[model samples]
Target: MTRVLVIEDDPIIGEMLTLYLTEEQFIVQRVESAREGKFALGTFNPDILLLDLMLPDASGTELCSQFRQLTAIPIIVISMKTAVADRIQAISAGADDFLVKPFSMQELKVRMKAVLRRVTTPKPVAVQHTQADSASMPESQLGLSLDLERRTIVLDGDHIETTFSEYEIMKLFFQHPGRVFSREELINAVRGIDSFINDRAIDVHVTNLRRKLEKNPKEPQFIKTVWGVGYKFIK
Candidate 1:
């Protein structure tokens, strides 16, 4: 059975999570304080961690950073802080995903499963070395073209510098247009399962990619947002 460690302060929410996760056949260990959570980490080997951002003893972001330094265990932050900055900070601190208050049990379960799947699934192989390896490659899309051999992108005949992260992300996007990948999925797909890169970095890479590839970054055409979800490439 998969083990889950939940470090949340609210009794009502803690009890609610325990009940729901138990129903889903997960072996859950709940702690109400950050201190106890730290202790549990030393003693219990959990498959995943369900952490709250606010605790009586310590800041959840600090705790998350500390925990990440110790292990790569998947962490799904459950917090009441709904601000965009809060979400970005949580990811920067090393959380695998974030869920705000009043979230449904079904959504929590889905997120938990997604994090675990990313943790367990084998890392995908890198993109092909050149376009020759895969025919029918998109030569130009909305003025953005890729030179696989040169590992560079050209926009309207001018080469646009791209970092390895940006290159990989755009490559993935170009390979499968119209597929809506969640942030977690994009992190896993681009950086591999074992990479320690903060999930927030994906946003930075996408922003840079847009500035380079899109005619107008403010009003992008090739890469579009899926609202609350991640971005997708559109042909």
Candidate 2:
């Protein structure tokens, strides 16, 4: 069974999530505060985390950062804040997705499944060298190699962690280096064209990717902005 840890302060919302998730055959453990949530992380060892932004003890973003350092498990933040900034903040803090309050249970489930699918499914790594030949390639020759099975990026002999969206975006960039991709094209490729994700969200994902891959994010070397157009990978 898939284990889920929900950190929600509101009793009603917590109960509703537990009930619905349980009906879906998920093993859920809901907590009402950040402290409890932290404890559950060790005990429950959940496959995914459903976090509420307004926790009683600490903000969800803080916990999100902390949890991300401890585990690579996917996190989906649930909040009443609908501002684009809020969504960006959560994603920057390591959330895989964000859902506003008063959201339909069906929509939440779909988002959960989508996020989980990205994390669990192992896709082909898009790079010039195959995994077997990667070890034989010179360090300078190896640009960015994806390990979809582990959901990680091997860059310059370093293993870097990436969120689901970041991994998807990087995979697309590796497949078509030197091709400028507009924000709309990137959003469509990563999150589906029908997704309501803000265009700025793509910027946030790219920024995060740069932080992980580039030596200096201020002046990125691998992924460059085309100003007015979008971005392209030069690797």
lDDT of 1 at 215: 69
TM-score for each predicted model, relative to the true structure? 0.56, 0.81
Give all candidates' CA lDDT scores: 0.73, 0.80
- Judging by lDDT against the true structure, name the best candidate: 2
In model 2, which regions exceed 4 Å deviation? 121-142, 193-196
Q: How much does candidate 2 score in TM-score? A: 0.81
Model 1 off-target regions past 4 Å? 121-200, 203-235
Give the count of colliding residue pairs in each prediction: 0, 0
